[model samples]
Target: MLRLTVHRHFSTSSAFFANRAIVYHSNGNPRSVLSALTFPSLRSPPPNSLNIKYLLAPVNPADINVIEGVYPSKPSPTKLNSDNVFVAGNEGLAEVTGVGSGVSGFENGQWVVTGKQQCGTWRSGANVNVEDVIKVPKGASEVGAATITVNPATAYNMLSEFVDLKEGDWVIQNGANSAVGQAVIQIAASRGLKTINFIRNRENVDALKKQLEELGATHVTTYEELSQKSFRDKVKEWTGGKPLRLALNCVSGPETMSMARLLGSDAHLVSYGAMSKQPLSLPTSLFIFKNLKSVGYWQSRWYTERTKEEREKLMEVLVGLMREGKLKEPEHEIVTLGAGESDEEASNKVRDVMKNIMEGQYGKKVLLRLEGE
Candidate 1:
């Protein structure tokens, strides 16, 4: 059996349950600072709350950055009775196991995703307000529902909100093999927009290229190919001399500049991530002559600033596309946390996964399955 180390004290209640969470007391390297803490689950939720049992939570790159204290947004330290630590996840899917007296529109066995940001989803169970969770359709795939909020939403917004792109127009983006990039390709294709994708040259480059092509990418090239002057002529040929109107940059630095070079006059380049950890450097001529507009996108901030109804409307559209089989979930690997595993074992597994993520070798998103569906 898993060795449960109770990290917090709890008051007596009608019924008690055990819960485990991955938390950190201070922000630093995840391997050093992260720990698994077991505590007493709430016996009964408040009148307006529901008892949520996490089903699957994704380990995103941003989650690691948050743990490292490098990300722009931060989760506040939460006091779990006696332990003051921050839980370490931002997105996940959960099941409503118990609903309070005043809670409506939710019942036991319904799947939901947190509606709020910095929700600390990396836990087995918690008491949350009804309004804090968004009900996902019953038929949604675990991977799709668990990951819908961040990468897919980012792609959807970037493709639709920024450029005023239309059918047959070309959109260019680097890190095309990434989850967001894949989503971009699929979403754009669904909207009749073509995509020019750029990825790093790797040992399995051909296979990766083929996979993306199957997902409706118009063109897939390498960063090295993007740097060459001849590539611009090739893009011109591909578009039949049409200007590429929108460019999405995730790998900043020189790659971003190259993406900008592919844009036509009055084009927009919206950057969402900097995976290369390098700053974006652009030539002034492109801006002065081409009138290219540069912008940054943060899906979390969008959720924070937008009205709840507006957010739900956008989610409804995305979910509808998903249900129609137009948008497919990115490939993912499920990391199941065993009930019999110790806290140390769980921590080790998470650390190893995070290391693989840093190395960029996993090739699939990692989802933490706290329990069987």
Candidate 2:
């Protein structure tokens, strides 16, 4: 478990409050453009708003893509007092410090997550509308709640929505060591389905396989093993000749096509991420003869399109799994931000983390822990 040190102070006078945030003035490399800005004083929130003190925020690949100006959706630039800049980060967990007169369904000390992406989550605190955040189950760990909205949701939706999967059915996915991939393995296992996971051969390949198997993965292999014709016979032996009805592909290129070949007739191949930056190529015969269907999934778009009730129900199911110990939190490293740090110091620390993220230095997920209760 991750421990947080809290520093709490409050004043009746509005001018005595302070806040800090990681922001960018222009779209470019995160290391070059990102900076820290501090608000010397904050006024009380207006009616229908709540003062939120951020607890933990995660640095996701999509967040980096947004910083590089290549993502499909762009964050709107806004004034933080006088500077027109974009605040960094999208997903995080926060606590309600104060609520306005018109706000309901929330109170001081309750935890909530940003209801949508690009809400500028990497901050010490902010005043936001009640509808912009969703209350999370207090029983869930900070790391689990902080990282819930993106990867886990993606994995859950892909497993439940793409195909009518049932118990004893087998599903295959590449990039099986990724956060979403791991979630898929556990979630599928909980549903009584089997997973055939493929990952890149790493230095600690055996340890990695053991770790995933402990998480309920039916079978784990490497991309090299997946490419061999003989490996298909091994897959057959493992599944007892059961048809692989659904395939998840995050790493595109030839590796994805190879995985797709394992799917049975009329099966679905869902593409969510292209980490390899390679185009997907399918053999004409496989599409024509097997009637394989290629589809794409984007969780952000799904959140925007789905109804509020539907979203809440999905979250309820996920939270239930967490409470039941059916879902496990992924490995993570915490980056702490002290309350007394200067603007330059905060910027430097955040930039260092960003540089590491760009270089893939963090073997586990990176989450921010801001000071204050």
Candidate 3:
């Protein structure tokens, strides 16, 4: 379907090497964080692994972080040949091309998605343990392929993780405008839980609040309004004394303190991101007198270490909602890959988009699409 060359080793400061790629390539070095390119191998594995041909892969901030050396979750290299090292992408919807001699659950041409508890997420194909891939639902949309790893799972888990929030209870969160935040609002509402979402006032605060409320948010307030004591009082009255039990956060610093105070005694406050990138300042009294908790939620850690059967169940529920069109993927920029695309061409396109984020004008995730889907 497509052809290009690429390198898989990271012996230098640059994240990965690029020879050429079926995806794209830039001349010499790349300006985008992804290596000049990454390529799939043609080498044969010892009879026990399945060869996958990936259809779609998500380009997340964490994926960018991995390329930048900021993310701790890095894939170890595997020997494919004397010259080529194996690079794997963790989350992508793929199809099986070659089944191993002993593989049981899959056959050639079966559509699958990698759920291997490791990262192999950027390439076009993979050779993995047959037990590692999960069958994707039939007729799964191509556009929905690359977008389901961390945020959606985080939104699903955090709500049900530490507490069993009853129908009338409330869960508040900062960064309520993010994709995860939107998912949290939707899922919580489906369970009849109320949400008090907080966000930085950008364009159309009123409109944003209305949109979130339509998704079942109880209230959508901004960072500035968070400081007033009356706002907390209003939240208290709004909950009608049913108790605010959870706070899912990304922005910390001052907002954390304010949101923390809004919770009932022994309420759980889970911080998922450092949007402010500032350290959380906690008052000892919140822990001692109010019995409030400050917990950090890293979705990858949970995905790797927590309950699998349960997690898969949640994913099944999520995918069903998506199929029904009640839940939709975020709006994102798509980088096309096809019959004869170059790594540099893809890199240059991504560089422009990253420049947009640095300039504070970009929103939504970016997905890389492969040919022959």
Candidate 4:
């Protein structure tokens, strides 16, 4: 549990007054472009707004691309002190410290997260529109609430939107050790759906396999294992010839195509990422003969297209899973930046972690704790 105080309003002399953020002036490599900014004390929110203080924010791989100006959705430049900059962070868990007039659903101390994309959530506190945020159950762990808006939502949505999956159904995917992949495995298992999970061969392959299997993966193997002439035969034996109706691809390339080939007729191949930085290739025969359907998924677009009530319902279901222990928090490490630190000091610390994240130095998910605790 997090130990922190939520103030309804800020006074200049109070420790809660200062707000710090990770901001970038231009698009470039993260270490070069990312910086920290501290602003004056926050005031009460205006009508239909809420004063939110973030508790935990995850450092996702997409965050790096957004900083480099390569992602499709980018945050608008925000004013921090005298400088206009893009404060970084797409997802976080926040506490409502102050509610504005005409805001009837929220009050001080309730936890919430934004339903809209590119919320600029890295800052310690801000005034956000009430309609843009959704309440998270207080029973949710801080990390689960912070990270839920993206990966788990993507996993759940992909499984549900693409296919009419039923119990004993089979699903196949590559990049099976990824955060989203792990969520897919767990969610599928809860529904009695089996998963054929594939990952790159790593040094600790055996240990990795055990970890995923413990999470309920039906079959876990390396991409190289797919090369075996009898691999399809083995998959058939596992599923008893049930059609693999869905394939989730994050690492696109020949590896993904190989996974897709195992899907039966009229199956859907839903791709959400391309970690390999390689183009996907599939013989026209797969489409003409097998009736394979390929489509791309973006969680940001899903949020934009859905109604606020729909989004709230999705959160309600996910929070229920968290409380029931059907969902688990991803492996993570939190990088904390003290509010009392100088801007240069805080910026340097954030940049160092960004550098490490870009280099794949952190094997687990990286989360940020910018203000208290």
lDDT of all predictions, in order shown?
0.83, 0.84, 0.67, 0.86
* C-alpha positional error of residue 241 in candidate 2 after TM-score superposition, expressed in Å: 2.0
Task: In model 3, state the lDDT of residue 94.
Answer: 76
Model 2, range 184-222, lDDT digits (tens) per residue? 998999999999999999899999999999888999999
Error of 2 at 43 (Å): 3.2
- What TM-score should be assigned to candidate 4? 0.94
TM-score of 2: 0.92
Q: Which digits, one per residue and each the tens of the lDDT, describe model 3 over residues 1-373?
A: 1112554333222233322222212122113334424443545544778887777776665644544445677655543324333242456767788887877767787877666644455556567776566665553465564566567778988998888878778888999988889989888887888888998888888998998898878889988888886797788688887777788988888888888888888889898888898888878898999888889888777756745465556567777767876566777776665434444554565566556655556576666655432
What's the number of clashes in each of the models? 0, 0, 19, 0
Model 4: per-residue Cα lDDT at residue 157: 94
Give candidate 1 misplaced runs (Cα > 4 Å). 1-17
lDDT for residue 288 in candidate 3, whole number 0-100: 97
Model 2 residue runs over 4 Å out of place are 1-17, 40-42
Q: How far is candidate 3 from the true structure (C-alpha RMSD, Å)?
A: 5.7
> Against the true structure, what is each candidate's TM-score?
0.90, 0.92, 0.84, 0.94
Colliding residue pairs in candidate 4: none
Model 1 C-alpha lDDT per residue in residues 216-324, reported as the tens digit of each score: 8999999999888898899999999999889998889988887898888999889998889899889999889999888999999888888767777777877878888
Instruction: Report per-prediction Cα RMSD to one decimal.
Output: 4.4, 5.9, 5.7, 5.7
